[model samples]
Target: MGQRTVIPFGPQHPVLPEPVHLDLIIEDEKVIEAIPQLGFVHRGLEKLVQKKDYTAFVAVTERICGICSFGHSLGYSQTIEVLMSIEVPRRAEFLRVIWHELSRVHSHLLWLGLLADGFGYENLFMQCWRLRERVLDIFEATTGGRVILSACNVGGVNQDIFDEDLRGIVRVLDGMRGEFGELSKTFFRDRSVQNRLGGVGYLSKEEAQDLCIVGPFARASGVEEDIRSYGYGGYSALASFEPITSKRGDGYARCEVRAREVLQSMDIIAELVDKIPDTPLMTSVKGAPGADSIAVSRLEQPRGECFYYAKGNGTKYLERFRIRTPTSQNIAGMTKTLQGCDLADVPLNVLTIDPCISCTER
Candidate 1:
């Protein structure tokens, strides 16, 4: 047998912003197997459901991850709506869709920057983040918070977009479309990026499906299971909406899938703004009494499909709240992809899974 060396990749690595430890076993330059250690950032947020009122619990859900904050809150709200059988106003749903897609764009741009940084492309990283700043500015203007929007509520949204603000958002997204197209072209077509990412850390479609990967990870492997297809929020009315999928299942494929999604999200937002129906933004939600009714709700967050389970026990406080984020589901597939990869490709492979540790631990 050849000599094998064990190496610890992270709990606090420069490449990863989140804390995820990987114990890698390698022979020379090729990784043989990887053991992942999670729970470093576990905050026990799930246990808080019993202590906090249903309304206040939204804040806890939003804290799952700074990047996917809106998605978490929206999923939480949707779950509660299911439990209460409340039909959110059409306008509120549209607004929620707008914020959700904006959050998606922002999150994807942030990931693009991080991926660029991982590859030592400092200028590309900076450019991606500069574009992300525009999305953050829009979030602050509409929701009063840059990272955590806190705009979603149980029955509806807390804020409404004025006609002027709507037009401004459209203009910003239109401009961003051109910028994103250029950036994506450069990133995808550039020889250096292609050489580094193409055919690296490949996950076959069968492997991805067998392991049950989620979000862009699964989409890259030709899975078409986007929760948006369920017609929740305003997605049902989206005329040109289609979930992006690729069969290559490599790092390059994951990047391409995300880039395509960014464009699709922008298109959805534009359609939403154009079809804005005049209606009240919120509705009063009253408690429904039963023997702790539970409901499941799922949404296609930028990271992938997020699952929320909520149980109400005829009280202000929820009896139980469980959230299963996409990252949690993708962990297994990530470990599988790490096999036979070089140590240098680990970061990109891990990131291709988009490991949102906070969401997983919560």
Candidate 2:
């Protein structure tokens, strides 16, 4: 047997994107187990609902994680909309979905860049980020902010994208699609990449379901789970919708699923932008939620399913607010995959799950 030692992998690491810490038990060069250390960046954002009114708290929810910001605001607003029985306009729904899918594209691209960097491919990393900037430009044109748009409100969106601009957005994405397709070749065909991730961190469908994994991680394992298919928001208006999935259930499969999802998001955006109705953007909200009222909403974020829960007591301020981020749900699976992995490949395995430590801590 190899000599045993304990290694700590970042709340800070050169290659890790999020501030995630793992206590790894090593038997020689192989990982025997990995234990997650949480709350490194917790800020008590959920408790802020007590001080912020239901309408005002939309901003707070959006701040949960910059990458998943739109989904947070959308889900929190949806929960409040449910609590108050507010029916948002059809146009608003479509706009919300457009922004949400764009956010997903940005997130997946950023992740792809980080993944490339993890493999020491500096040029590829920069190329991935360069493509991501175009998505950010679209956000800046539509909502006036690159990261935190703060466009979603309790009843609907705060503003609308002009029809011309929406079409322009589609054109820009069409231009980028070809570029991204060329870049993805490295991830799929490169011998180095395949050796690094192809068969690493294999998780069977049963194990994924057993761990209650969500998002690309679960989909890669053949779980066939995606919250968007439920057709919430503008998704209901789409011609057809299906979850992107793979049965490989390995590190490469996870990468493949997310890479494909980036294209899927672009298509969803194109559909919503084309079909969006001509209606009012914002619907005025009045009165607080009913006393002792509770409502919940789930959104399929870039990484996976994010759940928001809210409770009200006949007041503007929510009595309780909570969020169960995808990272939180997938942490167990991360540790599970860590078992029996080579120490050098730990980062690749961890990145495949796309751990959002900030979201999880929040």
Candidate 3:
């Protein structure tokens, strides 16, 4: 029997962008167990709902994670809308979904680039980020901020994208489709990429359900669970929605699902702008939420299912606000996947779940 050793993986590492620290217990070259350490970057932002009024906290939620900025803001606003019974206009709802899906596209692209980098595919990494830049350009042109777009509010959006600009966004995504297709081919068919990732970290469908995994991570494990499938909000307006799933349950499957999701999100954005109605962007918000009123909302973030909760005290600020990010939910599944894997494959296996420590610990 090989001697076991304990190796601390990160709060800082070259491979992972987030400050996720893991104590990997390994025997020889195989990992036997992994213990995660979190809360290093906890900022106590959730408690700020007390200081920041209900409406003002939209910006605060937007800052939860740069990649999922629009999703966080949208989820928080949707929660407040339910609490206050705010009927967002149809046009606003469509716009919300458009921006939210765009966030998903860019986020997946960012993850794809990181995955490529993790595999030492430098050129592929640059190409992925270059395409991601186009999505950011769309955000910059519309919301004026590439990353932390402060566009969402409780009732609706702060900015209304005109039909002309919406068409422009579609055109841009359309143009990127061909290039993205080529990238997908490389990710799927490249011998090196396949050899590096294929069958590396396996999570069976039953295991995924047992762990209650969310988003593409679960989808990769063949669990057909997507918040969008329920058709909430503007998603109801979509022609059809089904989560992109792969039954392989490996690192390759994870990459494949995310790569495919970028394409799916682009199509969703196109549908949204096509059906977007011309109406008022923002609804007038009046009166505070009912005393002790609580509302919860769920969103399919880039990582997985994000949960938002808000409790109102019939005052300007919410009595309490909480967000359960997907990464936190998937952390257990991540550790479970680490057992019996090669020590060297740890980073790529961890990246497959796409951890966002900022959102998870906030």
Question: Model 3 off-target regions past 4 Å?
Answer: none
Error of 3 at 170 (Å): 0.6
Best by lDDT: 3
Per-candidate TM-scores read: 0.98, 0.98, 0.99
Write down the worst ten-residue block by lDDT for model 3: 270-279
1-362: candidate 1 lDDT, tens digit per residue:
56899999999999889899999999988899999998799888888988888888888888888888988998999898888888899999999999999999998899888988888899999999999999999999998999988999989999999978998998999999898888998898899999988988899888888988889989998988788877888887887557799989898999999988888888888888999888998889876524569899899888888888887788888787888888888999989989999988888888877778988887
lDDT for 59 (candidate 1): 88
lDDT of all predictions, in order shown?
Answer: 0.88, 0.91, 0.92
**Residue range 152-228, candidate 3, lDDT tens digits:** 88888899888999999999999999999999999989999999999988999999999899989999999999999
State which candidate, 1 or 3, has the greater lDDT. Answer: 3
lDDT of 1 at 201: 81
Sort by TM-score, top down from the best: 3, 2, 1
Clashing pairs in 3: none
Clash counts per candidate, in order, are 0, 0, 0
